[model samples]
Target: MIRLAIAISVVIAVPAWADIAEPSGFRGEPYTAPVPSTLQGAKVIDAEMALTLWAEDAGFVDVYPRTLKPQGLPEGTIWQEPRHDTIPGAIWLWNTGYESLTAEEMQRLEDGLASMTRGNPDMPLVIFCRADCWMSWNAAKRAVDLGYRKVMWFPGGIDEWQDALGPDLVRAEPVAP
Candidate 1:
């Protein structure tokens, strides 16, 4: 009788299974999906699969964190060289990132997505940068909101890509040696 009672309690304690609550990355922040349910269908992929399948044909956008260059150092600030770059074929668009974007930034994001669509909502768009980065999540969600039928979120972004495919695979963007 005690064994059965314990089994029943354990079953009751188990949370009901559900689709990934946050289809975007699992970061609770200014960038969590406003309507997480709507993100139910967003495809999430890794760098290897992305490179093998959609790398060549998808509208890849790099949502990597832009290195914020500090102006006028206070003194003795340890400033390390920013290692920022996009995947070989990913488009680098500034201000298309951030969970809380200004009106103009949002506009640019929408415009860029629309330009990629070119009236075809079914165009597969892959957005990524770093693993678990909120920037990519917000951007991909914005794409889906813009009626992009094929929105893919590469959670394992450039970091994973370089780890899997090597540094030679990425392209040095706006700033690099």
Candidate 2:
């Protein structure tokens, strides 16, 4: 009877589950979806707030995944990589937001953050991708994990930026570590 009672208590103590529950680690694929309202260690901001930060010269990072050219294609086939545009002065940190990353990939993110923040963990660094995208969420969480003191997550990413500002975004290339 005590065993059954303990089991019931455990079940009752469990929090209600939601489809968009924020996991302790990076979110998995189907990267576009609803995100949690808060990121524990970082500030979650909207487009207007992002603009304010931009005006303050905060470092912005675009974590939207880059499409890699397929391998084993016919030699005669032509391929063009997709172009990504971001907020002016925002650095593109391509492919660093995946749930799983190799050691080298993790190094890239660390190095990029270190460079952008000028080795100051307290610098205001904003990380983003697109509205409803978890890539930004993952990246922002990773930044917090890396000891960034002023990490801001612009969850409403480029979509919100374009709506709030204008179509004034510029093409960006990923920065080297």
Candidate 3:
């Protein structure tokens, strides 16, 4: 009888330890559907702008975070070409893979942004990773924190872009140089 009682207590205690919530609050922030003026405050660009930029070569800066990971790739490989095509003149900023980020990865992201911005305080930049992804959310927030006056967040990332443009877009090969 005592053994059974102890087992029940152990099971109850285990759940208490497992109930800890993630730090970002409710799986990070709430995400609204992409809109034109979504980046009004932080200079974020949504999927629509990314597509438009790809088609028209609009002069918006494209950036990605380290935490954003491609759907499938070998470990330690920072960037991958989208299975579908991407916007022209887009640049990859590998901070880390999807799932979680470490302090070192965040630092690398900050350094990358500094290099990309190149002291252009007024430079407008767009950052993305994947659709329905929290990495972009966290990355966008980081950009804002870094004092990027015009930062756009492409929530759809590559997924929505491929879906919208179909074959019209061009896919690039991942190069290691």
Per-model TM-score versus the true fold: 0.66, 0.86, 0.52
> Can you write out model 1's per-residue Cα lDDT over 48-128, one digit (the tens) per residue?
777864545778777655666589987888887476667776666655767667786777677666675676889888887
Find the 10 residues in a row with the least total lDDT in model 2: 12-21
For residue 31, give model 1's deviation from the true position in Å: 7.8
Q: Across residues 13-126, which tens digit of lDDT does each residue of candidate 3 receive? A: 644224332234212333332223243345555566776554554332233332335577887877843453345555554543234456766566666666666866456666
By lDDT, rank the candidates, best first: 2, 1, 3
The parts of candidate 2 lying over 4 Å away from their true place are 1-19
By how many angstroms RMSD does model 1 differ from the true structure?
A: 6.2
Model 1 ranges with Cα > 4 A deviation: 1-20, 23-39, 68-83, 166-177
Go through the candidates in order and give the C-alpha RMSD of each one to the true structure: 6.2, 6.7, 10.4
Clashes of each: 0, 0, 11
Error of 3 at 93 (Å): 2.7
lDDT of each: 0.67, 0.88, 0.53
Model 3 lDDT, full chain set: 0.53
Question: TM-score: which candidate is best?
Answer: 2
User: How many clashes in candidate 3?
Assistant: 11
Best by lDDT: 2
